[model samples]
Target: MSGHRKNSSDIHTPDLTSYPPSPSPSSYSSNSSSSKSSSSRNRVKGAARSVAGVFVSCFTPPEEDAHHNSSSAYGGSDAFTSSSDISGASDSTEGRRRGTARGIYATRNDSTHMKEPGSTIFTLAEIQTATKNFSPAFKVGQGGFGTVYKGQLQDGTLVAVKRAKKSMYDKNLGREFLSEVQALSKVEHLNLVKCYGYLQQGDERIIVVEYVANGTLREHLDCFNGNVLSLASRLDIAIDVAHAITYLHTYTDHPIIHRDIKSSNILLTEKLRAKVADFGFARLAADVESGQTHVSTQVKGTAGYLDPEYLKTYQLTEKSDVYSFGILLVELVTGRRPVESKRELDERVTARWAMKKFRDGQAITVLDPKLQESDANGPVLENILELALLCVNGSRKNRPTMRRCVEVLWNIRKEYKDLLA
Candidate 1:
């Protein structure tokens, strides 16, 4: 984490007082009618307000709210809904309803306590018992926050319990844990990790989320030897991730920019469905009506996935996520890590290497050998490679919005599926 931090004084920070405006609606005109576009924007704003309000309430004392009479300082339950039920709604009506519902849920709750409707509050004893007294044997994953253990409740439901590292317990880390819980609890998306509940007892803080059986995309590409991902499978993953980011950026009332978007943070289900995980670095985008283009904040992200422009200017934007997603796209195509120091200097950075090959009319050289073996996937792969190039462009302005990325990736996925059929 220390290495990922940049010194503010050493860099020439941009004048964010009057930041650049978001791309004009004309950029998105090709996809939706103006009326639909306006409607979508309203939904996003409404959702943003809902999330923002919940975040603020997290700082208030729980005792102030009698209805939220839970003993824990920060606790609530998120109602789980079937994915089909949520996704089956007609586009326009559903979009509007989502915005209004989020706003109502946020406001309807007791303001003093951060309450996630439909989420359950787990006792420390319950979590400890589920995780076998925090035994190392049940540990499935470890990250900066803490170790994640595979736990099973009394009802036979599996879950992932993430407990903060003992040494990292402090005001800042506590805030991050609460923020992650608040953020995850507020929104329910199939592509986003589900938070079943949380535990805050004395020195311990733990988050319980749905257990994704398969490992991360990073493991599948770099470590797993069981199966080679086909071009269609890779395209499916790309579309899943694109839709997740699109939901964060456009569908919410307030757009969230996932400051870190890398392969390891992407989890896979048994069916290889991708779910975006780890929201510790997630932040709300600049208020659109404020005429601001980005949020001015300290640079926080992994070295390889960090947005170069963000590093220089310290102005985080949705395009920053786009830049990282571009690197991810390259990884999907080439089966290379975002940054490979062991490789030749010229090919060390995946995005730079892929872009150079694409420009030199040697894009095929960067294609994973396994993918190259499939003649049937060549044309669709070429289209995907082109989209990846556009996403990783040095200039954020040149990068397509997440919505556009979703549209293009979905088209490619459909084509690849047809090819398979």
Candidate 2:
């Protein structure tokens, strides 16, 4: 845990001014992955240090940094980035190629190619045929929810099939299926994983979605995809995620707090554009316009990313996701996770340590070593960590809404790009 592991980035200690809270960044699972290995876990939030030499910031919490300075959650999921994992199918070559620079799936003007919001009920036989009786080779990702496979529909449409475990379904009958269906079927954006359909027969429950070809942001962080993300790519990804979350919180008919927003849940394209996926932990947020401050509910989300206020109050709000986003921002810049249990005590909580570095005029020390230091990246990094602290403020009321995140990131990107130019 000391020496540079496969996932550990080299760092240069340099002083930076003070700040509050934390954030991290991507590299995809539609937005999270299931890489359970210790090394992979550590690499999940590696960095946004260098985008072909572009620059950024990483933070220290104002108050909470003193409370939980160690990581309680170490990894997001447990698995590898198989060419065949998560959701999606194989059929059209146009769909399978993640390398296309075309930008949108089927293009923004062509809505005809998109799947409908409703589920296209599939028979178990079709599912069996598509996945070759659920062959092990067809498997892509597996987690608490179940297994994800690559499959092809009869008409040649490709999809990623997420089949729930029998034991889990037998106990609840609907949690995963109902949750995914409720969340995925309600919205459609270029940045969100598209749900093709689902099936709930007997002990079998499956949710089929459009396959994202590249990998999860976590996998990219670990360079599991055989390439490292440039700092510019990371910025674009942050923007993509910001847009997706903004849509979920504001644009959709019903507001959704992703509840789980980490490197693992972020999926990427060959172009490396990000798409937010895995709605098993997604929840509808309380309507703030109606005078509701928060949604009173059970606490459910990835450990390290959970909002401290939500943990104390059991009142969920969109700010909860913002807190997690702040953690991810910290991860992106510092090349670390919110929790790193295997590391030395003080180094265990990535955000707190990075934030403290930022506070003590050592922000440069916390950046992902994969990136080279430069004046161009300095201010960008500072503002990024600054925004992260604002988002991860210990008080939910102090956190900016997703829309605000978009605005701030937009400014950061513009500034970074300008500096680079």
Candidate 3:
């Protein structure tokens, strides 16, 4: 075990001496007495063997056991169930014990079970039927990774199915798909999207998630006609997004950095409540015990929203997400895309332009004209713009933590409410 080092304290050596003694031979010479004693001895041996079998099973790796049982747990479909499918089907006492044993082993190994431990495993054919064989009419959205289709399960449950692009079935994209499944399945929060389950068959990979009625925050901003998302709604959205990021950074079992935090990745419910979607580029923070401030890895994120420090050094910290959120805040206030080609060079980058306006005491220039025309809540909007500037600062050290960002937005929101009240 070159790579395997065990903690001595955690290794438990079973006490074999505690086992019951074998049944002794009967002294009586009667044939009937001898037969009964022999039967009783056989029962004792069988019981002992059962116990030994369970103990040996416990020593087997959880992932291996999960793989072995996957076919049985889910209907044996090669394209449908891999080790990733951990079903919620009812089981007997011994089956439960085996599952619990695997869970314990997984915890000891510093790995987590797939997201949604007992999520339903749908067959590829089932998913196809749900989406009308991937019809164009069912298409809801498309991204760099794949196309998302809206579909209804047989039970009338609405779901958004994300299908991986054929070209994206390569090794790198496959890893990303599994990573997203692992992250979304494990975490549950009001502002985070819920992953119902996933489908993986050969080159076809699909994720089934709860469908948010209002589509994406990007869609809202892009299609803003007039008087669509009110200033109050925008503030609420920023707060919602901030709270979600805070949860990922501090409240989870481990810090999760949503490397992609842009308007397109933030979805809205019917009430316009923001839910953070897309964990394809997310990464867990460095182990706390390791005393590492950040996890160094390859740079991967959208252009304008990416943190400059991360782009230069390839070292990712929670501040990277803070920087992106700052850009999103600007998007909420100004209704501008992160990167715009039609504008002049200095103003082409929304974050850079907003920061310049704030520095020049002309923050009003970056405010969406519609917001300015309203002639109310102007001061609150300016305060938010200032906060966004602090978030997108060139130095990561200057950016506030997500918790702090949430606090500032809440305070501004309260002030605006009081004015209206």
Query: RMSD of each candidate?
Result: 13.0, 16.8, 19.7
Candidate 3 residues 2-31, lDDT tens each? 011112222221121111221122211223
Comparison by TM-score, 2 against 3, better one: 2
Cα lDDT of candidate 2 equals 0.64
Q: Which digits, one per residue and each the tens of the lDDT, describe model 2 over residues 152-237?
A: 88877777899988773233224435666667666567898887777767667788888888889988877785677777788799
The candidate 1 region of ten consecutive residues with least summed lDDT is 73-82
**Model-by-model lDDT, in order?**
0.64, 0.64, 0.63
Cα lDDT tens digits for candidate 1, 1-421:
0002221222221221111233343432334355764664464345434544543544321211111111111011111111111111111111222233232112232212224422566798899899999899999988878899999988777889999876542444555576676556555566777777777666777888878989999888874856888777888898889878877776555677877789999999989899899876677777655556677776666766766666656667787888788778889988998777799988877777777676566777888876555655666756676776666544455565776677667666776678778
lDDT of 1: 0.64
Q: After TM-score superposition, what is the CA distance of residue 281 in candidate 2 from its true location, in Å?
A: 1.4
CA shift of 47, model 2, Å: 40
Report lDDT (Cα) of residue 210, candidate 2.
Answer: 81
Candidate 3: Cα lDDT at 228: 64
